[model samples]
Target: MRKDSEHPFRQFENDPGRHALVELFVREHCGKIKDLLRDCVPLAKGSFGNILGIRGKAATALGLALKEYPRKYESVIAPFAEQQRLSVNIPSAPRIWGSDQADGKDYVIMDEIPGVNLWALPQLQELPRAARLRIFLDALGIVDQYRKAGKRHNDITPSNLGVDATGDMRSFDPDFMSDLHQSDTDRFENKSVGSPAYMAPEAVINLPAGRGPHSDSFSMGATLIAAITGEILPKLLGENGVNDYFFYMLNTEKMQREIDVMLHEIIKDPVLLKVLLRLLHTDPAQRTVEPELRSELESGAADHRTMRYILDDYSPAYRTAVQQWEERMGMAGEQEGFMRTWLRRTAISCEKLIEFFKGLRNV
Candidate 1:
């Protein structure tokens, strides 16, 4: 969830003229929800819709869509939620309580995330560096999980991620979820998927392919950049002012310059910088080269020796990040073992990464 101030739908509730419309909408939906809900309490409104927390026996929250059945909730939203439950940060996906049509509006109730989003926290920089790094690792873990599953979380941002009481992370947005239903042609033809600030260059420039795991990696890297520098990535990259697609195409050189500056400024560790650059690469293929990476690995020519090379010169800061992350994950005294387990489970392939870097070098 975003900050209340940035929540545009909140204004409609406060505006004397627009307030009636919101109330009418909520009232009609509430009628349907109350029939199936107990101890319901109004939470807040967002641009997409409003949310409510269910007390008593439910011990959950509800999300009411402002729009009509945009996609098949049972197919798209429901399954996605179930799978996201397997995410590192989120313990379980919010269950779809039910959906109903009222006054031509549709509403659905899903379990509420019980934690504070990263953006809601004050003074993130003040948190221990290890703590901050853990956040990045957690986000990375989410991306890695989805990538291995050959799925994608189209939108990822601090505001869309939450930290529960157990210090685990969760994804809060449901609208942009994609099951990659489109064919190759449709994927290439899809438009921008989520927030622009964290979008990858391919998302801005290329149209033949839609945002994928690499784009997720780029957003994760941007989150890390924000964590380290305490500055939004777009601002740090001097990509602040203009967001239209044309501006990105017209200023390719300028964008590279911004990336160079950002890489130099926030990332002191060479290994981390290298990894981040690869993640944010302009060439979508170069970023991860999903097709190539997966294919080459399957061929077994490179022997899956990619990651070892990239981590050959591991940075101390990254070591610390890894150690801290492992410890927080309850592998405090088993770093090596935990890493092995993690590597096996992670969708990110070091061998594939090596191939990607090699291709970059050859180019």
Candidate 2:
């Protein structure tokens, strides 16, 4: 497949005709459309459509966010909106107020959830490690709920997530929410549905079997890494760029090494590092948020050891040994005997570390 320099949904923003159509629809449906549009602020622009924050009197009285899409997506957006409207209220998800079709456009009015996007939250990195981990675990729980309900957010990114005034995490932009039960023909295939930077490897490559809850887990893992490191997945993938990012994702060995290096740079807790690596496993079948792990995180019952403390108090010597062995192996020449000795030593130490981490999985 060729590089997708531009997602098809982006065209809606650039099409003069589509803009005119949205303007016409607002004029006909929203009384004093000019005044209302004047007060509306651009909140976000995603692959599927644009989200505008309703401000002034309309916003105060209605407390709604306006999301619009080209009429061509009516079949997809309409059903998804209606499903959200009827579903039992999911506390972490934005409520869909209603949907309408007119003038070659489909509009969804939803609750304008209060608070900043996850990425924009102030002092996020400065927060305690457990606090930061809680935020993401809560976010992951929201995704898990959607999965249990036979729905998939499809697009899970830091920008699409919010931390409400109550400190609860809420997922935004439901325009790409999809039903897992929907037939393949009705689904948005391939890379057309998600944010390129955070999409799952299978979704990025448009695999034949399609995506499921594990796909969301992969995105969540990437988001977790971003929250901790302040670097997006593309940046973590390095100079080879996004195309290589996708290629590396499909190659398990390379993906593991990349994730290990990135996480090790910022996260010192071995258990946390292992959990993240599992979530980001290249194979969808192997990627998951373990129930025990999720429960501990969500309940705030998990270990609250600080990153520095964890490194200092828990097996620092073993980690140091592993690091030194790796460095030596990297600098070693092609002497078979020298290489074999360090390789065996590194493998044994890594196994002990892995066992130590495994014992802490429940902690």
Candidate 3:
């Protein structure tokens, strides 16, 4: 039980205008200012607002999170609430209980989704490979839902995601949600409002035609990369690196090389690596849709095939020839075995092998 002063809403106390807005919001939607101050518990804080969880008589049957933002954001928050009201298929998105504007602020009361933030969960490295893949697919599915609804969450970072007890990934804090049906002018007005670390290359530069479903795909790729490697794109590049990658070096061969190096550090599955590279492409048009990516991931083809699986599919003579070639090349070093080197060099080669075997079988 923390004191009222410790609550995130108190941060606005020094500013008279925002302080008045907070008091108004608490009184009108929550209850008496004193009651809210005594019972409200801080949930999360963000650049746009402070989320407080209501308890006791003030809380709804299912519980609620009160988020307060400055009145200036009414244009964004108001529309988001309306969109949530109309949205039916996106269960991962927070359900807004109510929203109102008064004084100099906007307040939205929404369901308190139960879960731990995805970023705060145990490191991906500690989790089994299958679990890591599940997390990526689940997160991508959430993005897919938004895409199907003709909306894009401009901010898709790990902090805005959560995993519940049932292992389902949920998206929250949609302050930057954008409708794809909007005119170009409306879409680009707030193009730059997103987390820089996970922002798409187009959104980073405020490219007017660049912020669309593809941009969300780019952010989703970056988010998954961060979750997988535990290294954010900005931090991996060092100070001023995000700007350099998105602004100065965009669409250059050097940028491609940088992307390759980053992907190679953690991603080994050829299909996954190819998909992520496409998602992180400098050109938004080149990015693939989340549903297609999800389908590819779920199919067993995405899993790295073991030597035994390959051997079973091929002839013994072919395996003997491969062994002979490995022996001749003396490629059995502890650091780099023949198969490991082959897989690293031939990312798409495995696909080619499958095609060749299918051709032979057809013959």
Model 2 stretches with alpha carbons more than 4 Å out: 1-39, 46-49, 55-59, 72-80, 86-88, 181-186, 189-191, 204-206, 295-363
Per-residue lDDT of candidate 3, residues 1-363 (tens digit) = 011112111121123333233233333554333444356677778558788776653242223566778877655443744555633357777656556554566667665654456566555555555555666667667777888877787788878886532235678777767775453348545434677778766664445655655778888888877876778876665536656656643554556577778788768876568778887787777886556666766764212223122321333432343333233223322222323343344223445445545655797
TM-score head-to-head 1 vs 2, winner: 2
- Candidate 3 versus the native: TM-score? 0.66
Off by over 4 Å in 1: 1-31, 34-39, 42-47, 56-97, 180-193, 227-230, 242-246, 249-254, 268-275, 285-363
**Which residue pairs clash in candidate 3?**
none
Model 3 per-residue lDDT at 285:
78
Number of backbone-clashing residue pairs for each candidate, in the order shown: 6, 0, 0
Among all windows of ten consecutive residues in candidate 1, which has the lowest summed lDDT?
1-10
For 253-306, candidate 1 gives per-residue lDDT tens digits of 677667877787767655446556666666555555244333332342211122
In candidate 2, which residue pairs get closer than 3 Å at backbone N, Cα or C atoms, i.e. clash? none
Error of 1 at 104 (Å): 3.3
- Compared with the true structure, all predictions reach lDDT values of 0.47, 0.57, 0.58
Best by TM-score: 3
Tens-digit per-residue lDDT, 281-363, candidate 2: 77777777687766656554223223222322333342343233224234222223432342344323444445545655756
